[model samples]
Target: MEIIVAKSAGFCFGVDNAVKKVYQLLDTNNERIFTFGPVIHNDQVVNYLKRKGVKIVNDIDEVNEKGHIVIRAHGVTPVIYKKIKDKGLILEDATCPYVKKIHNLVEQKSSEGYRIIIVGDKNHPEVIGINGWCNDNAYIVNSADDVEKLKKSDEKICVVAQTTITKEKWHEVNEALKEKFENILKFDTICSATTKRQSEVEEISKVVDLMIIMGDKKSSNTQKLCDISRKHCPLTFKVETSLDLPQIDVEKIKKIGISAGASTPDWVIEEVIRKMSELNNQEVTKNEVNQEDFNFADALEESFVRIRPGEIIKGKVIGFNANEVYVDLGYKADGIIPLEEYTDIPDFQIEKEVKVGDEIEVFVQQINDGEGNVRLSKKQVDINKAWEDVEKAYNDKTPLKAVVVEVVNGGVVASYRGVRIFVPGSQLSDRYVKDLKDFLKRTIEVRLIDFNQKRRKLVGSARVILEERKEKASKEIWETIEVGKTYNGVVKSLTDFGAFVDIGGVDGLIHVSELSWSRVNHPSEVLKVGDTVEVHVLEFDKDKKKISLGYRKEEDNPWVKVGQMYKEGVIVTVKVLRMTPFGAFVEVIEGVDGLVHISQISNKRITKVEDVLEVGMKVDAKIIEMDLENKKINLSIKEVKPIDPPDNNAKETGENKEEPEITEHKEEMEVTLADVIKTSEEVKS
Candidate 1:
């Protein structure tokens, strides 16, 4: 029989590190050594350690004396660490780095109001440790059915996987979760080492007649490997060591494959290989596989092109999920680009951008990214090309489009082709930016003002682009501007004197008097900053770079309605505005005041206008004459009939009586000649 040994059949990096730490502690320290649990899943290793005076304690309370406590590769919860400190035990942490990352992720996500979902065996020690980080409130789902049983909710859900679980299981559980939750965050936390070992076993089992899966029965990853092997080859046997090797028919089995779990020791694999070689009646070395019946496919698989880190390669898109895309790199292992490595655009949609059978170029980040998949980065390639273009644009004085991603202390951070460009607050616009957050998620054109290639620093200015456009527009406006020609403009600012409006990049002043036909106390009464208004150019001084704009339309002038609104012998109600020595200036309408001479104050004789009429008093009057040319009106209060006073008896008895309503005819008017006469009389006095 020919033997094919899986290359990835031994202790993985994390398991090796943990076991080595235990042995090193055993030899260097004279004090008693204790492990939080069995150092690994293998029974032989644990028994051997026990023989060497290493005590295995399931709980912290079980340790009666002080000693060096080594945490196992399967890690412990935060409470366990606290207990170790309380008991004054020296901790030699051996938790896997990848597992520690999961702890941190769950803790942070849970604090951010995400419901944590762990896709793995609930009883597993690793899952338990991860659950502890999220306050032990995580939903542990082992299969799609478990996920289906969960009620659908709008709460954001963050999904993570046990390091040893299969990728298929992780994906399956995630797919089920997507059906129930709209906002689900998935982190494929499966250990890369476990993936490689499982993948190797699946490939070997396909060609082998008999397969031997070696690892402890309690090992979850080992059991998964056995299941994969059994599905491919019916004559699959699981064994803990050489002693457990099952009886095999040598005549029927031409090729036999051997694989081991991540926690299995190298010595155990070698011993098993030795037993298999003896059965084949041949001497075999660890590195040499029987080549008598080796096929061309196996040779070609081993001779596939070698890949190196930092090298650019072309690949065909084979598959994709929300978090990552898989590409066939024409090598033994396919490449995977995580979502973060694809693009920096916040709204980047992978499905919309990528498709199967599409060929693309990628930068190799790692030849083997723990999970036996080549780690690739499309963003790095884009950023590399983008920086070259950015530098060229900076030297050529060209503008580039960028999306704002964050608002920082001094400026906003914008992303252009995955590269971050800092646009300072002063550079955001020509006008002051009151709130920087308004620019977040907005795309704007920017010019590169500063570039530091060595330090990877890039500073951009949107204001520069704006200024250039405005300069061009100002030139055009100056060449084509015409008096009385209307143009749409945006109000830039408001002041007591006037409003500055931007009409096609040229700022023109709109005096407060020109804002409306009626009198205005301030420009803000008619126009505010950012209001769009139709303004006509009243006049301009080319040398002074000043343009006066008119906002009030002629149709809106109050005097335009005077000829149609009022005529001679018209009855009206007027409000007394102020008292002059000769008469009281009474307002007929807004911006139109008529004088009521002291002689016309009432039918009864009065010495002064103030004797019968006080300021702000309303009275009935008739327009006896109108000077439309000079915009004046002569009013006489004596021409209109007045109502008699109420009886004193009725007033004392509190009798309610309905008074006739005075109808006041209102009309728009401009400054009347009455104001000129009143000013001259006041000056003489």
Candidate 2:
């Protein structure tokens, strides 16, 4: 006969804390001591406290005046706290630390611009307190699907669990809530005490004959322990006290295991164990307990020492078998680990976090019960720890080390803190990097920018590093650069009027005509994006941040040659560039132009000059004059060619019908008396 009890089979820190708080009030205080609610979910403990002169009060108004009012371990709302304080009653504050943390989280995150979500039963007191702290902005939800009612926001949100929430279901709720919110902060907040109790019961339930579970029926976590045990052995039964159990069939039972709820007393666990121990000595011809039933013993025969499945033990690999490795988990059974778990070369003689004889955490996945062996998963433990780290990174805004797995535009993909973080194209380096892949497989430090716990999305920024590098480069470049010096630069951009050259970190313009000694119609005709050319800096407008530059300084000025081509009143044919209201600059020769005004274009009465001439038209023009002082030219298009008149000298050979065209006129005005007298006097002379 064998009896095995879990090391952590009974009530934990929180339940003990609450139980002690109520007992102190009952022992020392004289007033009608009353707890606002049950001190814990356990009715057995609550009823025990009631028997000790403690009364449970459902309403604040029901409390007697000046009574010693004890707030239950589940915690009370600030509204209720204030109301009780206002009543002038003596108060006992006994809220558990785990529950109190949720209250504080609600207050802090709500103040810092996050809406609170409470994951648990709405009727629970802890969640009610959590809701009150946020001015009722907290929404209550029970299951995974219940999160659908929440309105979406780009704003940050805080999620917390009720202290007694089941570990696995809490995961479901957390995963579900995180899916809808872009910015979600999840605080597991499930009391550590609750986790210990659950894990203990889950592990203990495996090898027990008939198990006795001690807990109050109303206790949620206690009921959870009972449910976990029944999956292993259906004979396990729940009993609040010894009164609930019948006389045991000691003759048939040999190995019996006993576990308790978190609220169950230590004395209670001891009493149950004592009653079962006497059963092992009965006259029952039971099957013997086999130490070799655990799979770890079977793997050792093959000299492979790794933990077998379904056995929780620590181990270090000392040697290997043909198909497995050996780990010595300091138990009676040498552990056997499958070789498949070791993917790479055995990482020994290095900075190993674990090694042979080094203790490590692993999950018992299965028991090779047939071969007296077990299968354990080290990878599962690593993944579990990884999720915890990823959650911590999401909470703390920490920078993590990662390898750049792939290069993408503007950034790289790096696995940081066990999450695939996206480095955007803008963040690949400290400066502008046109090629991102060069950084692939290279280790880098990255800060997480965008992350989600539910979707497991993480985004990083290498651009921040790139920007920092850019600033440093700019400082160095600026230190040596002067306002008027000349440097070689690449033409980075071209426009209709000029080209923009990248002179170190600065950009300067090169006017189209200044590009060469001859004509330049457009900047693109001579320059391209990467063309390296030398230029002289003419002016640096510090206020405007504009740099005026000149090209073609190595050659003679094109305008100097123009002075020789044009002269005043020199008629020269030219091509029209553009027509303005005042005049048009006509290219009489390459790079030499003269202006032809609208008035000089034609001899006829002109209403609109555009009606007669169009741009890009090559026509004859006469340079009537040039103004060298003003760099202006005057031109004439009308004088280029003169139209000849019709000839009148041809002999008239056909019809005489035109004979009446002109009449001979006499009697011109008053050749009056004065004229007649003058004519007669001249004749007499």
Candidate 3:
């Protein structure tokens, strides 16, 4: 049988590091070694450590002797760390870095008033540990159905996944949460190594006659691999070691595929491969297999080939410190990426960005850095790909997001995926940018307007993107604009005559006369730049690209309630506004005025109305004639009766005094043709 082994099989970076830590503790120290739990899920590896005098305890209190305690890769909660410290035990933290990142994320988000949701099996140790970080308040869900049971809430939600869960499970739960919650943050925290292993099994199982999954049954990642394989290949068998291999019909199986979980050790995989090869060889000789079958039998014995220098390959991040990050390239020597080689960005924090079990593409710099390590450069790979992406964006006329990193002499420099592009001051915005420093560290969208790959020069214009969006918005506004329709707009600028408001992309003017029912001398009296106001489309000319907007509301018009508020013969206190040649104008209410003629100024004849009613005087007047259509009211002060006051001497004597009764009467005057014509002209005025 032809045996095809999956490339991403066997122990991942985290599991390997954890197991190695246990051995190192055993070899160097005489103190009793205790693990918080089984260091790994593989039974063979755990048993081997137990035989070597390593003790396993579920809790810190279970440790009877003072010794070194190693926290397993599946990290424990803060309570465990406190217990270890209180017991005075030497703590060796073997928690996977990627899992630790989730702990920090949950703790921060929970403190910030976000409800934490973990997408994984709640019973799993990793999920339980993560819950502890959030004060054991996280909602653990494994599928879409579990999300349905949660109560809908407006609280901001933060969703994180267990490091070993399948990508499909994470995606399914996230999609369900999106439908239920309006504000949610989803972090796909599934380990890259787990994803790679699951994907490889799916691909291999499709064409193979028999698929063999190797790992402990208790391992979550292992069970997931078996589940994925069974869907494509029914002849899938899961085994822990070579001794547990199931009986297979070697003659019938022409091709067999092999894949292992992250917890499975390399020795176990090699042993299984050796046993399968022996079985295939025996069947071939007995059946007198053809030359092609013999060649397939020999293929099982071949080992992994060595990688050459300067080759680009995928590696899993195993561990990292301040100086460098270590990667496993499926080779003997681990790859080392120095800080400078990892990224060009100066403020890059390795601990926050690089995590264990993450897959990264690296360019091999050297086979040996004189320290028996493979030197790798991740920045080199990124730089090479960034140029290609930049060229594509330039050719396709696609916009890219970039952050302004520096302000130079004539322009600003923006960094796009570590590639610097110069944006001239003129291209920074459609309007003049007085200070380029304002764009510093701010993210802006830009399209490449010019570039030269050979010269390593590029130019981008944020103005181009702004203009394009403005043009599209202008078109949409003109298509749907209707006269007298109201819109919410923001005041863009102010002038003496009007205020210009941006309803969408188009700017419409609100004349000072239309700003309010009350007179407005300047647009600034009613609106300032950036003030939001509701305006109606009074008139518009599409060809001129001009619009006239009205800001005064019909409901706010003072004349709307005049008919209900006033009528003829009603008494009112009026304020004299100004004196006209024919009459004195008084304000009845805001924006409404009444005219009092000289003839009706008082009971006695008056030559001038201003003589009795000067400007700014408050006087009681009776409304005689009202014309609602013309918005005019005629008031007569002489028609209103005055109240007489009692003498103070009568009160001092305690004598009852009679009060004088007041009566309203009109004064008759001689009439003339010129007088009648002049009165008529005064009423009209």
What TM-scores do the predictions have?
0.45, 0.40, 0.44
Best by TM-score: 1
In lDDT terms, how accurate is model 3? 0.83
Runs of candidate 2 exceeding 4 Å displacement = 149-153, 246-252, 281-685
RMSD per candidate (Å) reads 22.6, 26.4, 21.6
Q: How close is candidate 2 to the true structure, as a TM-score?
A: 0.40
Highest lDDT, which number?
1
CA lDDT of each prediction against the hidden true structure: 0.84, 0.67, 0.83
lDDT, candidate 1, 163-186, per-residue tens:
988888988888898889999988
Residue 141 error for model 2, in Å? 2.5
Can you give the lDDT of residue 196 in candidate 3? 84
Regions more than 4 Å wrong, model 1: 1-339, 346-376, 404-413, 422-444, 449-464, 562-601, 607-631, 634-640, 643-685
1-685: candidate 2 lDDT, tens digit per residue: 5666666656666666677777777667687887786777654455445446676676677775678887767787788888888888788888877788888888999999897888888866677877888998887889877887766677788888888777887888878877778888888898876777677667667876777788765567677788888888778878765545545666666566667777666655555665666655433222222121212223323443345455545655543445565444443233455644432222222224334334666567664423333455665565556667766765786656677766665566776433467888776664466677767777777767777878877787756654565567555545665656788888988999999987766678988877876778899888898899988877776556677888886436545666676566666667778877775667766755677777777665444556566777777766677665676677787788632222332225444334334222233334466698999999999
Candidate 3, poorest ten consecutive residues by summed lDDT? 285-294
Best of the two (2, 3) by TM-score: 3
